[model samples]
Target: MLLNQFLVLGAALFAFGVYGLLVRRNVVLILLSVELMLNAVNINLIAFESYLVSAQAVGQVFAIFVITVAAAEVGIGLAIVLMIFRNRKSANVDDLSLMRW
Candidate 1:
């Protein structure tokens, strides 16, 4: 119920997401971690919106925009990952070197 509680939860989620992003080797896991981070941000935005009691619901609107962007990101990211996997037969981030000349 408290704003601090929501903030703490959001921070914890964000930290976990960052850890996953940095430590994971699988591309899918990294994408999931990014989603987690985005969800944490959504939580914070809604929490702030509720706490501030604004008439326009700006935080919720922004969160919706973020969700939309994140969806598009995941779609594009997975498509690329799928193509990479098809070509390389692996999804590990360390194995990717398509950008190198």
Candidate 2:
């Protein structure tokens, strides 16, 4: 209901996302964690727009932009992960060192 509540929820989501990103080795789970973080950002943006900002739609527009970017990110991220899986026969991030050579 309140802006602070939304902010707390967003923070919690972001924290979980970060923890998942750091702990998970699978590319797919990492991508999902990234999506979680992005959603948290979107929540914060909308909350701020609704509570702090003026009547302008700037926050909503930014939120939309974030959503668009997140969608593209998921598409490209999944494609890259799929290719990696196909070539490496594994989806583990630790196995991604082949690109360094």
Candidate 3:
């Protein structure tokens, strides 16, 4: 209910996302972790927007932008991942070396 509670929940979600991003080796899982981080940011934005009671709803607007960007990112990311998986037959991040000469 309180602002601090929302903030703490957001922080916790962000922390978990960071941990997953660092520890996961699968590309899909990495993408999911990124989504989690973005969701955490959204939660924080909404919480602040509600707490501030602003007329412009700036935080919510920014959150919407973030969501839009995240969606685009997921689309592009999955496309790349799908291509890589088709070529290599695995979705593990450690297996990707297409950037190297």
Candidate 4:
């Protein structure tokens, strides 16, 4: 019962994070939402591992990978945002419309 509840909650969080990422325009906020989604996924992975099996290390390993990937993604994203801001003098997505046309 409790496991199912946790799973559902984790799923909900992941869904909301994805929605926020798609809906938000700010680069920094999008990165934050991505982090939230990754965390929610990690929660689900760890929870299922702990509840379904005796081997706890696999989920932990994957969670560590996710964290590492998220950190790298954020670093790259921030660098790109800074570069874009420097070139365009703004961070707003609407400002980037110039690049499209």
Stretches of model 2 off by over 4 angstroms after superposition: 99-101
lDDT of 4 by residue, 1-101 (tens): 57888799899999999998999888888888999999999998888878876565788788899999999999999999999999988877767886584
The candidate maximizing lDDT is 1
Query: What tens digits encode model 1's per-residue C-alpha lDDT throughout 3-46?
Result: 99999999999999999999999999999999999999999999
Stretches of candidate 3 exceeding 4 Å from the true structure = 98-101
What is the Cα-based TM-score of model 4? Answer: 0.89
Between candidates 3 and 4, the one scoring higher on lDDT is 3
Total colliding residue pairs, candidate 4: 0
lDDT ranking from best candidate downward: 1, 3, 2, 4
**Which of the two candidates, 1 or 3, achieves a greater lDDT against the reference?**
1
TM-score of each: 0.94, 0.92, 0.92, 0.89
Question: How many steric clashes between backbone atoms does each model show?
Answer: 0, 0, 0, 0
Task: Order the numbered candidates by TM-score, best leading.
Answer: 1, 3, 2, 4
Candidate 1 vs candidate 4: the lDDT winner is: 1
lDDT of 3 by residue, 9-78 (tens): 9999999999999999999999999999999999999999999978999999999999999999999999
How high is the lDDT of residue 11 in model 2?
A: 100
**lDDT (CA) for every model shown?**
0.97, 0.95, 0.96, 0.88
